[model samples]
Target: MDKHRNLDCKDIEAITALLSKDGEALNYYKTNGAESVGHAFMIANLLHLHANVSEASLFYRHAFNLHGKSQTEYPLPQSLLQVSLLCLLKAGQPVPEEEIKELEKYAPSYANYIRGILIAWRGGDVKEAMSLIGNAFEGFHSGEEIDALYLEIALKYFPALTAPITDTSYSPIPRHLYMYWDKNPPKEIADNIKYHQELLGEDFTFFNQENAEEWLFEHFGSETLSLFQNTKHPAESADFLRLHVILNNGGWWLDADLRLKSLEQWEMLSRLPKNCRFFITEKFLIHNDFFGTVANDPILANALLTCYVNMLKHHGLYIPYKTGPGVFSRAVSRTVYSSFNHDAPLPSLAIGTAWEMFSIVEEFEVTYKSGGNWHTA
Candidate 1:
């Protein structure tokens, strides 16, 4: 008999509610495999969230095993399988060759990434692992939570993966601050932009919805404008626009929600070597919220844009990634790789801050809170 078939609506509801109660849900699910494969998957997600890698892996294995007994669909099985490998990596265990090979049937592209990550993590090559993870997200596009989990797991093993750079060898890039919004800004966002503009003086440029669209059309013509209009995700368009504008006219690109902490922080970034591509690191992944480079760095940013354009075509302009940080990081990784072969010596990509240097003073309704609710505050 299929044990999971015995689960009732009440049992499913109870299992789901336990997710927010920490140890309660996981414990209940552990003792009650009859609770359903869905419950097992939920518990695995919770365990991953709490950074309980070993336990999460166990639950993920449980969920994966239930496939023969249950009716889970396509991508779910593939995602669970891939994340199990991540769980093993996070736990500091070498992923077995068989496990990587098994997942290859479901995701060939992902299989390659998992293999690369396995080698990198097992060999203690954190930098390569970081790049692989970033590139993986570019093609993956599952969910932000899964991406965060992957990043958290990598950071657990390599804490210095995003450590700050104190070297003063970098040149000063454009002093300009560039930000854009497709809609009217809230009071907090406007005030924050105003504050930065005041500090930066003539160097600040705040592009509103029309201004940004007009700038896109003016610079790239009707085809790019059509692409921007066709993309359903605001964040994707914002990300694409940011990189294009920065590549065309080099300067600082800060997310509207991210604010500079102080003048001293600005000064620190202002003094960096100008031509290098500077990014702010958060945990293991480079954040798209803050980064800058000198204008038109020997066709490097153009190459990055070309990569992104290709991604847009391949992914059909998806949200939270197709043109967002994942794509940005992937493009940077490719640029870095190409620079090695070419004598043009493309500007290097470096993490400028060890941790997130700016503060997100405003809260969005879409962002998840610790209490398992989306905060509108």
Candidate 2:
């Protein structure tokens, strides 16, 4: 309230300039004793929000350390205390053991929740994760909001890995891409997992209907065909069975709809017979926008039956995926006539009216017959 007090304001400006630099405020707090809780917590929050994570974690420790605690003028909903620690944990900042001891002086349950957070943060245990969330709020549903934010932090910070797509319970089957996902994780958790970033490629598979599967088993024998995920999308699912396929690996691609009296009937399987890289199906007629259902690939067949609402990325317009080959074939049209297969017919049913890439499909023996009543050998 006096002119002499105005003279002290200039020192504040000089210190403010160094705020961007780490440890500056902590050092100032050590020397000047910071006057009040507001200044110290503000400095700590600035570092936590702006500095790179490791630096921020160190700064946060210092902030809590120097502020000398008991900042709450009023008690938060009993649970938000747990929520607070969850946020700190998600931020990759550990609550100090000394602070934990101090909090225990007030409430034992909250301290227990902090312990749970530490355990869940160290080892990914769902029980600990849920318990920490349960202990985070008292009256209202702030626990839900905290859990949501914490999960957002993990998902944003860490790559999501969901329940194993399949635990076929066997050793490595056939896969090139290992898709690891957690439905959603805390955002900060992603920042801590720097080693996890990688480009994910497509996993191609094919599926057939139950009758189709019966037909497949009847004709090819179970030994040659590996049955995976019975729900459908077999064409795409088949590829995921091995996890991922690298481009140009010798994997034979086929739509489940393309039936066979015998697997040995097609000579294409003979020349490039390897099961690693993805296989191009009996080339479609041409990017015809045809549905695979006509062809009988239940994988595509089932995908068409989904109730989730919309086709976000692949907004291809087609009546039914029955003629997917025709649609895809039209996309890249190349007639693959096999001099080897005595019965190789022109791809009439698989032909697409609007195919763009129809010129370069690899030549191989895949028979396509115009629709007929008789399903013959």
Best by TM-score: 1
Estimate the TM-score of every prediction: 0.66, 0.27
Local accuracy of candidate 2 as per-residue lDDT tens digits, 1-377: 11221112236554344453656555655565434434544554555555434333333333443443453642232332343454566667666675566556656666665675676667666444444434332322211233233332222222211111232232211322122112232343232222212211243333223433443456545732343222134332332221111112323233222222232322222332121111122321222111121123322222222211112222232222222322222211111212112234422122112121122121223222233421211
lDDT of each: 0.61, 0.32
The number of the candidate with the highest lDDT is 1
Q: What digit string (tens of lDDT, one per residue) describes model 1 on residues 103-132?
A: 777666567677656766566565555545
Clashing pairs in 1: 164-354, 170-272, 170-273, 171-272, 171-273, 171-274
Cα shift from native, residue 248, model 2 (Å): 53
Q: Which parts of model 1 are misplaced by more than 4 Å? A: 1-43, 66-73, 76-79, 92-98, 104-172, 230-234, 261-268, 297-318, 335-347, 356-377
